[model samples]
Target: MKRIAALFPGQASQYKGMGRDFYLQYQSVRDIFNRASEVIDKDVYSICQDEKMLQRTEYAQIGIMVLCIAIFDVVKREIESPIQFFAGHSIGEYAALTCSECLNFEDAVKLVQIRGTVMGKFGGEGKFAMANMGSASNDVIMEECIRFSDDIDFVSLSCDNSKEQKIVAGSSKAVKRLVEGTEDLFHGKVINNLGAFHTNYMLEAQKEFNETLCHAKFHEMKKVVFSNVTGRPYFDETQVYPLLGRQMVKTVKWRQTMDYLKKMNIDEYWEVGPGCVLTNILKREDPSINVKSADKILKMEGTGNEKIC
Candidate 1:
């Protein structure tokens, strides 16, 4: 028995004209991109065409959501499988909602657009995140995180392909402190993210996002969508709004979420957006599982199916 799980990627995973392929291929994809352009009063296509827009936080958010949604739409029409669940990283949660039908594509795009704007506004300056690669236990890293939580906030703990590799999110000051405290110091390599995301530092943006989502309409999910906050599957409409809001300010529980899916006997795992990041993470977590990037998905050309561990 194989189950299908769709993984939606977050911000830093974006690339140029991510939706152009689908936009040229699917009317629905074009319509969705056009609707997003209308909501923001900017030519999203132009933004997609321009390299600068795709790199900026705000435009990157819109482009990524549109592309991810479009990819999901293509899969829905072209492939048939018993999809067991859906999950997303950070802003990718909105993409999960669209896949689950909890929110319309237009509304989901609007939400993320505003989300990116708000994040840029309140996430403050002089703060950023860094990804650390290594083989370390969560508890050891978490203990290290807490040692600096007072200033660093230890906003996120991402389980990479294996227990030894993980990404930590926090302010520059705190991250620096943690690195200095640790032996080998991330093996001397750290990727500085554009902002301090997924930590308490973004709470102000989360507040505004919550208010906006509270007024929006969400339907009960026809399928399971996992919450990054709790690392659990939730399909109730009532829970969706709160969960999405908390996501901005909470740690992404990627490790627990995947484990939960494995326990449910998921068969296929598809990373539905740009980059093979999630696919790599899943494979590292369990090499026996079958996972593929969205490009691999499009190449399948038939039943884009696989078994997750």
Candidate 2:
């Protein structure tokens, strides 16, 4: 069996009718959605089909994860290859942990619901915000953020998507100024829908969600998984609670995560999610690395879904 590294994507990659293919073709996909629906007390399958509802944080977080997990189940059914490692961007980590058996599917869904609800309550109506800036190096983004920060207003890097793309979050005024000042240098835009995640702007959310993460039962990983906070393999199950809690209020080391995977003897990299965000990031970092997406997974040799909706 070829050694494989599986990566799951986080929020913002979701779209209308993302996982309808899996739901229409596989019983296991519907089963996963039904299981998740019981935890959140809402119809997950129906939520995926609604574009306006999917934009909300509460629905988007859980909906994206459930779809990702459903696709992962399909991948496992079709391929028997060994997974060398597992990791996710942000909310994607819960999917990684659930697939690796660190946390059960129901528990992962519950945590995401609570996480989304807590964070969603804040940073709305222009109290705070996040922005994406492209064509600027990570150092330049950080340097500029520092230059814009002050006691009353500040901005911090939330995600290091790649060397050229970085995201910032903080007081609305600060983020606006940062984007406006750097617009001439890079493509910058304010994110109005989602809250400021992966920054101290989420401190309250982190505190509220920490209790749930600690309360959730975690088990020994059946496969190795990397940390978005540390950019290294999780030492063991003991680190899951603290690391996941800290992830809420820290920069996601995505660039570092790709660096760590390079050392491992990975034969194939598969992105099992609705969108190809992770796949695109890997290609940008190293075009030579062989990678595939769920769409291609459905067409793998000797694989076919018998049942159709």
Candidate 3:
């Protein structure tokens, strides 16, 4: 049997009609969507179809997580390959956990709704910010991030997507400084963030998330799941909640995650989510690596890999 790594994409991978085809074709998917709507009372079915709502961090996070799981639910039954590993990018981790059986689908939806609202309240509302910086060595990027985070406002080195991709989030002032400080040496894009994700700026949300998590039941992982905090499979079932709780303020070690997967001799990388971002990112890192989105395994045409047109 081929060793498989199942990955999930994060926010910004959402589209207006991402899960519509799946919902239409699969009764199971429709049930998942409807249940998600009832769990959060946000009409997730309508949220995915509305452009304005999809753009909001709070709504987008919930919709994205639900879409990932709904798609995974179908893909799981279709695929013959046994998955050896699983990882999600940021908010995608919730879906990863849900699929891993660490958290139930209803609890996952409820958690993401709270996550979105809090993140949107802080980062999306303009209190906090995020930016993608690149075209420089990792050392240079870390130096600048550390300086701003320590001396200036709270800036965090958020997502390490790859050797060339680095994300930072913090106070708006600090992120602005990050952009200005690196403008001469590198290129960057300021992202519309719902919160200072994976940064200390999310402490308030982390607290609430922790409190909420206390009420949610987390089971042992049914399959190996990588954690953003460590860029490694969770140490044990007991660490699941704590790691997830602290995940909000920790850097997502995606670069390390890919490195770890390679070391594990993963033969195929499967991205079971709305966008191909996770699979594509891995491909860019190593062109020879085998990568596939859920569409191929599910034998479906619309995986929402393209922009909604």
Best by TM-score: 2
What's the candidate order when arranged by decreasing TM-score?
A: 2, 3, 1
Name the top lDDT candidate: 2
TM-score of 1: 0.87
**Whole-model alpha-carbon lDDT for candidate 1:** 0.74
What tens-digit string does per-residue lDDT give for candidate 3 at 55-111?
788888998888888888887776687666889999989988888888888888888
Between candidates 1 and 2, the one scoring higher on lDDT is 2
Off by over 4 Å in 1: 82-84, 149-162, 185-188, 296-309
Residues 171-290, candidate 2: write the lDDT tens digits.
888888898988888668987637678878788888988878888999987789988999888999998888888998989998888887887768888898878888988898789988
Reference-based lDDT, residue 184, model 2: 86
Which 10-residue window of candidate 3 scores lowest in summed lDDT?
Answer: 300-309
Question: Which scores higher on lDDT, 2 or 3?
Answer: 2
Q: For each candidate, what TM-score against the reference?
A: 0.87, 0.91, 0.90
lDDT of each: 0.74, 0.83, 0.80
Candidate 1 on 202-237: residue-level lDDT in tens? 788888877887787888778899888888988587
Candidate scoring better on lDDT of 1 and 3? 3
CA-only RMSD, every prediction: 3.9, 2.9, 3.7
